[model samples]
Target: MGRGLPGSISGGVKRRGLPGAAKEERIVVLETENAALHLKLAEYQGLAGRSTSEVLQLYSAHGQQQKLQRTSVVTQLHGTVKRLKQDLKRLRSFVLELSKDFQRQSKTYLYQILTAVQGIQLENEAMQMFQIKAFDLEQSLQEVTERYEKEKQKRRALHNSLVELRGNIRVHCRIRPLLPFDAASGHSISEDRQRNFPEKVAYAADDETVLIKCSRPGHASINRTFQFERVYNALESQDIVFADVAPLLTSLLDGYNVCIMAYGQTGSGKTYTMLGPQLEENFAFSIEDESELGIIPRATQEVFRLLSEKPPGSYWVEVSVVEVYNNEIFDLLAKDNYGKVFGVKREVVTTREGKSDVPLLMHETVENAAEFLHLVNKGVQLRVRHPTLVHAHSSRSHLVVTLTINTIISGDNFGTSWEDEQTSQRLNKEVSCTFPQKMRENKSTSSSRASSPTQLEATEKLKKVKTRLQLVDLAGSECVGMSGVTGAALRETSYINRSLSALADVLGAIAEQRSHVPYRNSKLTHLLQDSLGGDAKLLVMLCISPDQKYLTESMQTLGFGTRARQVQRGQLKKKNFPVPSKAK
Candidate 1:
């Protein structure tokens, strides 16, 4: 192979040289191919090593992730165990508090139960004692009831006798203390008027008599004694004065139309006796002052007190206040939006039944004493008053405070039934005709008399059991020159004097039993015709000044009252109505 290599190398050198050259070239080509292959293999080996290193890194990362997950689970378990321990501690504390509160409440409830049981036992014992006492009281009440009935009957009989004793038209005299001006006679004097001129003209001799000494201007002095139902002195308390008049109010409740009239000269105590002393406008009268109250206030209190004693719904009372000024009837209780007097005139009309009524009169229903006094004050403020020489607050009108008391009584009662029957008899007598047979036959049915007993009974059934309590405060009569009143006030004085004179004439006519009563002469006389002529209980309170200067006016007042007392109104007939059986 060497020879061949050498010789061939020589021969081959030429041939092999070509082949060797070819071989060399092929080797070179092969070497180049091998070098290229080695380069490719090295590139592949580098890629494989890079891939192995990445796989190992991924395995290490997975191991580290597992360890971190184990650590997180262990930490979460530790926190959960800590929270459970805290909840256990709070639950133990709440249980301890609940046990303590339960025990405290149980003890309190036990004490309350024991106390209630004891109280029930005591109440049971007391109830048994009450039952025993009630039996004893029942027997005592029966005996007491029998005695009460007897006493009540005796009281009724005595009341009837007293009513007979007090005449229909009762006259009382009141002598006012001498005013300063009355004593002075409007003349200056060194000493006080009351002390200098001691009342020597008028004196109360006894409870029922008044002695008057009158010195005429040109005639001789005259001493006169006047008889009256009562004579109140200057020093008499208001309570004492009211005591005599209190009986009349009781008669009013007995269903009699009662009229109390105050008449006097100017500056006399007519207003003072009827109302109290003059006060500021709208000043309320209070029960706190018992001594200061006059007849109107005292009568109001007494009426309300008596009414309270009666059963509720037995009586309904309506009050109306009107003033007769200048022959015109004016409402004193009518008010405007501002509570001032409305100053509206009311008409005085005589009903077909011969009863005088102030049409459209304002009637106030009073519930209690305060409300009545309030209305009284309101009316007093609305009264027309003017200052005069004789009196500071001289009233210029005749104020009539009428209390219409409508009583609903049971007809089943004996007294009420008897009264109803008597009223029927009286009505029959009043309706008896004195006309001739021809006049009676010619009379129309509308004008015919209700002579039948059945018709009279029917009439009685329709009649309201109402009685009026009229408290009249007549404006005092004044001397035109002495009063120093001019203009409208002078005119008022004229009207007042005229009305008073007409009243005197009417009274004189009634006392003399004249056919013409003269009641229609003046508005005042006509308005008072019922009280003056009818069978109504009338009380004339004559107020006079105990002064020498007022002797003439005082004598006139006494004469008028004396005439009124002589008026023989047969008897005061109580208003009676037949009560329905259903009402009873």
Candidate 2:
């Protein structure tokens, strides 16, 4: 009903262009006239009754009501159209405001994007610059490393020059630190007012001097100062002690006998300085214990390193290990008929040239440092040792390790000549089962002469130049009461004390220029005869303890060192002649 009037009113307004009230009046007049016509037709058809006029009136009233409804519908449609036009105007303004906001946000977003792009470009350039600097730094590091290596080599050469200028004998004193065992008790000390426990009685006054402060009851206090080639304090490291001894290696290769001997009282660091301190009670060594290796291992490594710098195959090395136990010499490397190593009796005979030689000594040729140390470790395992009160494992024998370096040089290099007939007589007296390396050298000499003079000159010019490096670890002097030994150890200790006495006697005689220096009194002195009496470079490393308990023995050791330093041997005589000075 609502849609019908609005649609018809819209069409009527469009067609006739009528106002609202007038359109309603015209619709009512047409309905009244139609009702009257309907009444007349009913009468013509002979169906008119009294109620026909009444029905026509009712029909007119119904039509009049429909006109009012159509009028109200037109009014409502006009108001609705006006309200829709207003809402459309407001919506248009809102859309324009939203568009402006979007434009401002897009502008800000574009600026942020530009800034981020610029920052990324700067970062890329910085990365490239950093890479360039890293490469430059790497190159500089490599250059520094090369210079450091050169400096190390130069330092060794300069120090050896100073050693050569010093003299033939070098005596060094090392004062070890106070140990835990210096006190009578390990964990606690007694409340005695007489003796102070673990006190430092010796000190290094300077780099070359040691000062000892001695005070005895009812005796004038004695403050003694001794000068040595080098005095190392307890604060020094093993490397520092070896630094002074390293120059001797160069002298050994230069055709001179070099001897390094360690002498000290019992509980002193005699074995510790020669070999490293062994923590394990057994004879095994760990792989990571390189820093703990002592003078012997380091010297062996240095020898191989120096040889590596020389021409390949120009030199041969042989090693011999011997121990003096209870005044007898036993070869450590000597084997039985079944090819197993055992102690064998060896005799030290004085040659016609007055040099001592071990004829039946077992000589092992070593190709590298590791092999040499392995053989040494094997021999050390077989050494005789027993635990004492002061030391856990005290070495009861004196160890001697000799390294013989055979160098071949031109005959004209040194004035010494080996006549062909003389060398033959000496070679013929040798036993058949000699060292393989020595046999090879002797056989090479047999093929010396040739038809061509060039070949003969070549053969004769090659003379065997042999030099000896003797590393000796002498048995420590013992205090009978302190060592607390019984049956077997007491006897070994007696022998050790006597041999040390013989060494001191030889030094005393040499200092006084006696007609007869007693070298054959003990086996230790006899074996070291050439080094002590001949023109060999000798270094006696005196290891002492700062413990007040062993003060007497320490003083005796220091006194022995003083005597060794007083012996004025002549300048070193190398196989090759020394460079003549301007005076010559």
Candidate 3:
């Protein structure tokens, strides 16, 4: 049994070894097949239809991949086509509606355009009618303007006649614009107050009224209004002023004594209104500044121009310049012992004939306006002027410029000169000795002309008509505190105030019809006796500043002007007298 077991074990070992050999043989066969596949890869270059390439690829068929992809692509293309057809259908509908809207809107706009055209045509026709009406209105306005101008002239004439009959002094107010020195005129102006208040405080309310507006911070506002015969605003030129004053010159030429005086506060343009901005001592009247010429220079020129139209030497004009300083009259044309012209103090005396005269007053006969202005310039050099808080070239004295016109008439063809004075007292006395005798002469002189050449040639009687034109520039009223004057200027202020007060008192007396008109109260009143009391046409010019600093002074000036306008001195008696001509 042992022997048989050994032989079986050997047989089992042989069987196992034989199985191992068979497995090795199968692996060798697989490696050879792989090598052959590698050779096929080298021949085809790892891809089909690549003869020179060496490659090997192994592909497997899917279930339906290409068919599924193509199906998806075709489905997407169908979706796109369906969306395009829907979009085209929507676009066609939108286009059709857009065309209909365009047509509808075009019709609407065309209708509106036609309606606008019709409306424009109607407006054109209406405009033509309106233009015709406007033309008619313009023509009517032109006619009315012409009529108004004519009525204005007639009204002016009638007004003058009424004034002449009533014998009321005409007052004109002039409101000057605010000036720099106006603040200096008043010491009350402070920096804070100046900032609080506006500059212009006074103005012209109308052609005949002056209004003062006193508005201040934390103060009761006050407003004052005044009326006068005429009111000139700041915008008015000196020419406009002269135009109104030229009529007085006509009265002067017609044998009427006329006095034109300027009254106002210091730095209120009184001097500028009278003597002009050329009040300087060395001022030369230039034609370039012709528009700036004030009343005095312009009057001088106008008088000469009027005289030029008269017959040669028919009238001789003698001009005299006088200045009142410290209540004393000084002849500015007076000659000293050295033949040098200086202001010679003169006495103003009331004559027995109720007329005022200045003895030894130098009157220079001027042939033309040039000579007259030249003499005035000389007098201005001698006139007293000092720097004040108000005005830099303030006039400290009153200036009186008198033009004495002598109407010389003799034979019908011949002329006579003023060479004969029967006595030295003739210069001091009027032509007539008494008022009643003057009235008789006034009545008889007119009838005497009818008796004419027969009676005139038999006696060889010559007549001379004398008239006086007095233009006065009064010294401005000033307050000592406001002017800050000292020494001589203080004295001047005192005199000036007193004299102005006296003038106001005289006007009050006249306005009240007092029997005793205080004409002799001051030299100013005494000098202006004829103009104030006697039969003479007097015009008062009230000048005012538009500054609040001068409000008080402006009110006072306006008050004075108001009182002056109320004085009715009886009908103006014509000063027509035939003085016996000097027998040559």
Candidate 4:
């Protein structure tokens, strides 16, 4: 019975084992299916990756083809640009040739017309003078007999007395003190008290005055004294000077040479008055407004304003700025090494009228105040400067800026019909009568005369018109002891004093009406000879300090002013001297 039970239990165990084995086999088959799926998925993924790579390669090949096409287009464009550049070069050459040809033809026509007109005009004038003289003689002969008997008796009764007289009318301008910046407060201190005040506590009248005071700490005390004569307040004084000189400037537009100069002692606001006190705020001043206009800027504005009012092509204005350093002339507009000093030689050209002093041309065009200031600032940078006990940034030399005005009157008749017709008829009749048909008919004779080098040159000379206007700023005359100058400054001081003394001598001689005034004694006097004693309308600004400390110097300055006032060049009129064409 135990054996039979064991066999049945074993069979039962076998049966359980068989089901477990079948479950394991099913698990294995599922596992095998999972592996097969994974392998198929891997194979599919590999094929997809290959397809993507092929597509990427095709895209890359397309990009390369596009790049090649773009390169070809760029190359063609470069070639076209090169050809266009060549064409532009040719066009420039052609334009230059055309300009040269136009200039030459214009000059030739001008010369021919001028020669014919001048000759006829001269002959007509001579004939008119002759006829007038002949008529006057005829009238005189008729009256001679009647007056001869009465004149004899009157001459016998006349008493013999010789009287010679000379006199001059001196025009002086006493510019009133400008309104104080703080006039609203009315708490201004006396000049004496202001001088004694502490450095920082010292009150300045305006922004520019404050900048000037700060620029040279030591000179502030002395500068405060001169407030009455020449105010450091650029906001006030510069505009006033422009107003004062407006009349003289107006005459400049009428073909007259005008010179405006600033003369004073060192540290006496010469630079401040002429160039304005150095301050960034001063640039805010505009040329359009008189309240903000400076000397140079205002002058340029006035000139252009007048130019605009004049008939077009009737006038042209050119500007040049030059500096005189150590009695030597230097062209401020010249180009040179960044820091090197470049100078130009002055040439004395002899003209038909007389010997003329012609400075080297440094032509510049100034359209506005800002442009003018830029050129002036560039010039200021190039100007010689040094530190001194009196002024931290003292001007080492004098600077002069000249504006040359050239005006041409086109002989083209712009007058009314009556005047034009009259002139035309008169000109035609005069031309025919003076030349005679015989002369006109002889082509060889006319050609020979026209082709003559001297005649052609003279004819060319008379065709154009030119005028000059000069604005000069003289260096301040300084005393060594007052300036506390030494070494190089001492030498400069000596040159300055000597030149100023020479200037004083020239003024004295002019006052005395000496026939032989020594103008060549110094370069300053020589350069200013025409403006001082010649036809130029001169305005001498006698800068003085009101402080008691400068009383003696102020007195001397006033005395100089008095002497300057005594000098006169008579009732001088503008003289348009004939210039040789080749002089330039």
Best by TM-score: 3
Each model's number of backbone clashes?
4, 0, 6, 0
Candidate 3 regions with alpha-carbon error over 4 angstroms:
1-98, 120-152, 182-197, 217-221, 279-287, 411-460, 577-584
lDDT, candidate 3, 433-531, per-residue tens: 212232323221111123345444543534566788889999999966567788998888888888999999998998888989988878888988998
Please report the TM-score between candidate 3 and the true structure: 0.72
Error of 1 at 205 (Å): 1.2
User: Which lDDT value does model 4 have at 9?
Assistant: 50
Candidate 4 lDDT, 306-412, residue by residue in tens: 55654333333445556666666566666556744354545323245543455444555544445556666666666666655445566777776766554433245
lDDT of 2 by residue, 1-584 (tens): 33355456557765988887877677666556556666777676555554687679888888888888888899899889888888888888888888888888888888888888888889878887987888888888878878876885586456445545544457899998888667653222223312446777799997679998977666577698988878999988878888888878877765678899999987788777888776466754333577667888889998888766544444567777889999899988887889787878787878898888777678777767887777777677778888787777888999998887765544443533322344333333331222234444522111111235644554554556678889998999988776778799999999999999999999899878898999899998998898888557899999999876677788999999988877766556686622112111
- Superior by TM-score: candidate 1 or candidate 4: 1
Please identify model 2 stretches exceeding 4 Å from their true place. 1-168, 185-196, 216-220, 284-287, 412-460, 577-584
TM-score: model 2 vs. ground truth:
0.63
- How accurate locally, in lDDT, is each candidate? 0.73, 0.75, 0.76, 0.54
- Judge candidate 2 at residue 467 and give its lDDT: 82
Minimum summed lDDT over a 10-residue window in model 2 is located at 442-451
- Alpha-carbon runs more than 4 Å astray in model 1: 1-168, 187-199, 214-219, 281-288, 336-341, 410-463, 577-584
RMSD of 1: 19.2
Cα lDDT for residue 575, candidate 3: 55
